[model samples]
Target chain A: EAGVTQSPRYAVLQEGQAVSFWCDPISGHDTLYWYQQPRDQGPQLLVYFRDEAVIDNSQLPSDRFSAVRPKGTNSTLKIQSAKQGDTATYLCASSPGLGYSQNTLYFGAGTRLSVL
Target chain B: AQSVTQPDARVTVSEGASLQLRCKYSSSVTPYLFWYVQYPRQGLQLLLKYYSGDPVVQGVNGFEAEFSKSNSSFHLRKASVHWSDSAVYFCAVRNSGGSNAKLTFGKGTKLSVKS
Candidate 1:
């Protein structure tokens, strides 16, 4: 079975530059999530989707961060104006459903971003 | 709101020694719990999960966690350590009592094994 896939694995941007991270979730997965992990810290949820509709995006920075999963199979997270604080590993995970206890999130290698 | 706490930021032990990683949680009610491990330059992988019923759940790589409702804790334990087991371990909780809340993670504990 193929796992969740993300690209480009690494990205570097100067302040105010824009960047987009892409994710391809596992086949048949109904839930997709995006998280941000700072250095030596745990991942923080940025946004999530269930079959092309956003389930929650409360943590996403409205001013610069935007995510879309129009086809329900792939997703894209965009940062309009990158800042140093946005320099974190962008992680994408997928699960079968949102059944609370039954959901087991499978993650991708993540895109390590560095905003100068 | 649901939250997780990993009391130990780091732990060191010899290869043959036993290991235990502590986790505490706070929520309006007992939530679904989980443990995950992350290898160097890799993403998080599920170790185990607990919702209800038995207080103990077994996970991959000989890992197991015991949930204690009274203490509001779920601690990960291994019979003996291996060098390959050195990684960052994260404890998480979901608002599984009723809501569709997402999994919340702790700061994580970095385990180091000495051969």
Candidate 2:
């Protein structure tokens, strides 16, 4: 019963640099989501996928942010030309299904990103 | 659109004291509600959830939440608090009917237990 796993527990970069965060969801989970949590704030959804197909990404910054779940088991969220505003914790979560009662999300420790 | 609100930014309570955290939601229809707790340097963990039926639902660690449709609120409560219960509590909501339902979270309430 392994929980969701994320890589690079922390990251620091200068402005204009690029970085990517990876996530490995729990086995058999079909829904994967990426969220951004600013300091002292709740998580904001960035993008989500269900079985390799993106379900929603309206909040994603099209110019710099991108995400993909090629094989449906793992996902990667990238930020190009990072800025100071991008300094936040990048969280990854997954759920078993889309059912109203069963979609409880399980989250990872999150990658704390700092852009100077 | 759906949203959640946590009125209290922080709360302090003595050990063994009763606790209550306030939450309110705005949505066109009845939404699925949830409460999650986040410990230091840890991810969010589900405390409890309410989709329908009973207005009160029990969660892990002796936590419970009551849903009030008239007030559009779901408040977390505990009969007795413990020092270990100190953490940031977040209230969330998601539309009951949707294909790609996303949980909208509140700013969160930070609870401190004083021994």
Candidate 3:
């Protein structure tokens, strides 16, 4: 089976520009997540969805960051007016279900975004 | 609420040397602990997980971790490491009971295995 897939392995943009990342989770997986990983840091949760319904997004920078999983299979994370601090790798992951036993997430190669 | 801490930011070990990566978590309840490895641009991969039962849990590629409730730690260990073992390892924890729980990650420990 194919693993979680992310598009535009690399992306570069100027400050104040916008960029969107796309992700296709492992087939049949019901939970999807978007995380931002800064250099020398661990991946931080930005947003997540469970079958089309957002579970948590408090960590997401509401003013500029937004994410959606309309059909609950694929997800898109968008950053409006990107900042230099936004230069980080965006990772997408998916799980089989809820709870600890179902918490294993399969991740994609990630979208490396750079704001010039 | 739950949080994970990886005290070591970097660790270097010669090939065929034993290695251990420390991970500590803070949670009021019985939390779910996991260790993940990231290779350069690649995404994080599950190395091992601990939920309940025997403390020692083995994972892929000869990696293992022991969970200790008293210490609140889940440290990853390997009998011997190879050059391919070089990567960034992250320790994460999630509330075992919650409606919408998310895994909290640590700063990560970069292991550089020398041949």
Candidate 4:
């Protein structure tokens, strides 16, 4: 079984530039999440969706970041105006369900973004 | 709100020696706990998880963790360490209640195995 897939394993951009990261989750998974991991830090939740409906996005930087899962299988996270603080690895994860036992998330290798 | 703490930022252990990495969590209620390992340039992989029942849980790659409610700690352990076991380990927690509880992660502990 193939795991979660993400594209553009690395990205380098200048300040104020815009970029988008895509994710394809495992088949049959209903929960998809986007996380930002700064160097030497743990993954922080940016947004999440369950079957095309956003479940939570309170932590997302609304002004510059946006995410969508239109068909409920694939997702895209975008940064409108990147900043130096946006330099971090963007990780995509998915789970089978929302229940306790099915909450284990499988992650992608992540897209390492660098804003100069 | 839930949070996870990994006291040790780095740990060095000789091969074939026992190992232990500590984790602590803060939550209003008992939360689902997890341990994940991330290799260089790789995504995080599940090592083990504890939801309920036994305080000790076994995971992949000969890894195990003990959950102590009184101590509010979940520490990963291995009877014998291998060089391949070197990686950054993250401890996570998820609230049991509510429908949209997200997982909270620790800063992570980097383990180095000396041969």
lDDT of each: 0.92, 0.94, 0.93, 0.95
TM-score of 1: 0.97
List the RMSD of every prediction in angstroms.
1.3, 0.9, 1.0, 0.9
Error of 1 at B94 (Å): 0.5
- lDDT by residue (B1-115, candidate 2, tens digit) is 9999999999999999999999999988888999999998889999999999999999999999999999999999999999999999999999887675688999999999999
For model 2, chain A alone compared with the true chain A gives a TM-score of 0.96
- Model 2: clashing residue pairs? none
The per-residue C-alpha lDDT of model 4 at residue A79 equals 97
Comparing 1 and 4 on TM-score, the stronger one:
4
Name the docking class for model 2. Answer: high
Regions more than 4 Å wrong, model 2? A98-101
Give a tens-digit lDDT track for model 1, residues B1-115: 8899998999999998999999999987768898999998899999999988999999998999999999999999999999999999999988764436477899999999999
Off by more than 4 A, model 1: A98-102, B97-101
The candidate that wins on DockQ is 3
Residue-level lDDT for A82 in candidate 2: 100
The alpha-carbon interface RMSD of model 3 comes to 0.8
Q: List the residue pairs that clash in candidate 1.
A: none
Candidate 3 lDDT (Cα, 0 to 1): 0.93
Residue-level lDDT of model 3, residues B6-63, one tens digit each, is 9999999999999999999999899889999999989999999988899999999999
Q: Which lDDT value does model 1 have at B76?
A: 99
Per-candidate count of clashing residue pairs (backbone under 3 Å): 0, 0, 0, 0
Native contacts matched by each model = 0.68, 0.74, 0.82, 0.76
Which order, best to worst by lDDT? 4, 2, 3, 1
Report the error of model 1 at residue A3, Å.
0.4
